[model samples]
Target: MSVDSASGVTVPEPVPAGVVLRPPDSSVRRNQRLLARLGWLYSAPALLLVAAVTIFPIVFSVVMSLSHVTVSGSGFALGGFTGSNYSAMFGAQLWRYALEFTLAYTFGTVLVEIVLGTLVALVLERLTIARGWLMALLLIPWAMVTVISAELWDYIYNGVYGVGTSILHDLGMQQPNLLGTPTAAIISMAAADIWKTTPFVSIIVVSGLVMLPVELTEAARIDGANGWQIFWRVTLPQLRPTLALAVLFRILQAFGLFDLPYVLTGGGPGNKTESLALLGWQTMFSDLDFGPGAAVAVSTAALTLIGCLLFLKVFRSQVGKEEL
Candidate 1:
């Protein structure tokens, strides 16, 4: 095809087969590829750190749990392993008691914390004055170092000069040493935990409460729903996910409780307050039995992981139903 300039008439150019003319600049594609590579390079340090800190320790612990290794004893090699540690733990009566006590303590503390925390959150949310100061005051217990909190509580529960006993006596209540008896010790531990962690749960619940759409509650109110009815029918369902997450975290924290019980009761008056973590610590450090202790520690980790997964699954299911 050709065009004649003088005649001002043009003939169409023939299209070439399988030929295409595209824009020349490929910098955008090149930059995208470059960026992808840079991202991986930037993330390498974090990935390496995680592997070194988290993955290596987890693998080492698993290996240690299966072998007979102690502070003075080293008969078993790392690669050469046995199931004796697990077998011994499973065959023991003390293991059962440890498990039961751990479960009881975890459940009791978490339950009380959640209930009290939720109620506090509700009241705080409804309050129009002094809420900020109250929240700050509630956080003081949480802010204290765990060991310090334990020591403080220990002084308060002391038999001779303890304010707790004095106050009880003043109220016409006969009070023994708080940590002397098993039941009382467990109750005391739970009280300390509730005092420390209820604020944490309240913070989580309060966030959810604040994020909730007010229209739903107002609509329910307009429909003549009572306060309790509105709460059960509206508020509770909305808060389920946050509550589950908070409770899951609390359960894990309570299950691994050591410092408070250690300082308060020394896991004593006998092994009444002895949790699985404390038992594992005693086995590893005090008794110098690394193999058995690592096994116990591994079991605790596995159980905690399972509990968290179950909680998340249940929470997801509930949230899904609510969404539907």
Candidate 2:
């Protein structure tokens, strides 16, 4: 016990018992830990669902790749495991062609879309009036679904009834089969993709344009710089980060290149336009070679992973510059 000198009252002092009182911060720490656990409990279901849908299939296929699995009358069983699956996947000539075509298609479409979309964005950003209507017109192509747009293009390029054929016939010359030859089919498919997806790029560029500083452009104009000079120096560099991000988005989507090629070319004209995704699908589903098919799927995933990693470096550069 202790005595207060002023009040002359006895007060309880510290107890020396074995039970120790927790400090306020310790109590708070305990409460935070409890809440964190509860948060994880709440999130567990979603995490499990994602694992089931995405992680499980990837792991399963990886396992399948190591086995001699085939779509036989017997059920799937793991035995005769060998590296032959990878050998078959890499040894094939068709797979190489598909891979090359996929790369070409991705780059081809992305290049055209970026150029065209940037041009459209520049034009729209300079307009003084009716941009709302113009924006709507711009989004029309992007709003249409990819498969539908591809099918539309397929009809447009139809050998017999297409507009191109009609025009050629009117000119009194041989109606060149647009989708019948390998090079023409690939070019036609790329054109369809560019037509459908360019508006999306334009939307991204336009968003970046809206955030651009008018003062910079004004200063350039005051310094007696021409329109082309100002835009080439000021506008394009400002848009690079957004352009990098947009390219990543488009490349991821374009590298897959499944439904568009499927609907338009059917990997036709002797499989000249087969994308990696389509080839993987055809191998896994159509041919029923589970081992080699899984290998194809893995290889495609690796290919995409490399592309994504490369873009991530560019994205990181953008982020670093912004942080500075």
Candidate 3:
């Protein structure tokens, strides 16, 4: 005999017709329902805090970018709404140069980091002795504070008392100021960043390597693959995602380079090493041009976001290829 549900039509029941057949009582079910709701209640505070800090600043920046906000005679004033701030950013050659410099800095540093970091991770993976201590040693530079490291490099690059200057004179050359030239200064800045962040990239890559399937590699070896061949066929494809993540992170971090260049070059040598972040800071604080500064910040942030998205897109395609 068939019985209808609560919204019921007529039913032929095994028990009495009016007797509803409710599902069996379960403490587990009731507990699960309570826990699901409790989970949301617990997470609400942290989620709200994150939204307040992140969303608010991004919204405020976009808004300020649209308006001509300036420090007025008595106080800050919004000089109505216009896109002149962003237009000025585009028209100025300074901003364009800074943008190009930032891109080059990001590419150079991240490329070096990826190559060196991967090599380091591979060496560590094959190490039979003192790997843990060696990993710790590698992490020391990464743990050092950015400003302190930059200052240390600046001292080394000093025109008078610098190790660099001493070496130059010992080689019978004139006194050298590493930061006094455009190319040398840019290279010096990239070197400092590579020293600081390569360990970070290696650590992430090493984690991915740890999860790599040993059996698959062994199988490839048994099939007559050499070290490079097995790596090319087995390990590299597996590492694609991890490498993509490493590149994305370094790109974002290096694109905002300010502290190192500020300490080392002060954006001088014709402002050849000036980054957009440095420019934004100068505009906002040094020149006190709020509108243009916000616009710079907004444009840079947008560009970084696009870069991240593109990396993810390419990584996703690589993943699909692996599946096939």
Candidate 4:
């Protein structure tokens, strides 16, 4: 090519050493496309099943929420689409109460769970003896079915001849009916939730604690950092993501608060303990108002999604500041 340039004639550039030029193979690309198509074909059944199981129900629920639905012997009879369902939900005082109660319950329980769970995880992380046995014991509460756990709590809070009542009576609190009143019922439900789910949070946090880089803590200690200082400065920042994940999971589950209130209080004491889930159930199954019920469900889902998004945004901003 240089000699051809000197000769002032057009010439192809010389190929670099250890390089080869060749035409692209159309067959290779065709084979790759075929494999991709085959993979999609193989996955199509599972995708369809997932749609049937999850997506269809969601879409149907949204549709039901938007329509005038009536229950018949045949099935749900859907009438013309209307906004009455959401309007009724918005105008009803019971819906407002349930929304407020559910939000309060979710906030209180998730906050307590995160704090208690993180403490438990920290303690568990430092324990070198019987850690597995301790963890198994801790997990018992979480492993129990929610219904069964609620039932057990129900028994404990029974107005008469119950263990909690008996202990309270002996402590000079006479006739302390734990679930007989609004405030007491709310507290009892929150206690049961905290007791049952704190272990779950602890497990997640413990896993994160286990995976944290030990070198950071050691370095912090070598720099004259105390245990509290190390925890605040070195440990907590790294654990932010794990804590955010735990918060997200707990918020989602707690916002759908139902089983505990249903089994323990039955949304009783003047429906003070009624949650959005309980309200939806009562509206649909008890009142046979499927449209408003679906609206309640859809609203709960939307609120939960919004709350989680806001939390994640705040968490990300906080993490960014910490990183900076």
Local accuracy by lDDT, each model? 0.87, 0.87, 0.89, 0.93
Cand. 1 TM to true fold = 0.87
Query: Over the stretch 1-324, how does candidate 3's per-residue lDDT look in tens digits?
Result: 564777567766468768877665797689889999999999999989998999898998888889978687797777678999999999999999999999988988899999999999999989889989989999999999899999999988888899877898899878677888998888878888999999999998998999998999999989999999988889998898889889988988888888998888889888898899999989988999999999999999999999889889988987998799
Give the best candidate by TM-score. 4
**lDDT (tens digit, per residue) of candidate 2 on 1-324:** 999999999999977879787779989899999999999999999999999999999998888888988465875566777899999889999999999989988888899999999999888888889988988987888899888888788788898899876776788858778899998888888888888888889889988999999999999999999999998998888888889878989998898889887898789988998988898898888887878888888888888989999889877897688669
Give candidate 3's error at residue 174 in angstroms: 2.5
Question: What residue pairs clash in candidate 1, if any at all?
Answer: none
Clashing pairs in 4: none
Candidate 1 vs candidate 4: the lDDT winner is 4
Over the stretch 1-324, how does candidate 4's per-residue lDDT look in tens digits? Answer: 444656778777888999988657997788889999999999999999999999998899999999989788887899998999999999999999999999888999999999999999999999999999999999999999999999998889888767899899999997898999899989989999999999999999999999999999999899999999999988998998999999999999999998998999889899899999999999999989999999999999999999999999999899889778
Residue range 1-324, candidate 1, lDDT tens digits: 799799978978877999886655697688889999999999999999999999998888899998867453544345458899899888877777888999988888888889999999999999889988988998899889998988988888888889887887788877677888988888888888888899999988988999999999999999999999999999998888789879988888888888987889877879988888998899888877788888999999999999888888877887888789
Worst 10 residues of 3 by lDDT: 5-14
The TM-scores of all predictions, comma-separated, are: 0.87, 0.86, 0.86, 0.90
Clashing pairs for predicted structure model 2, backbone only: none
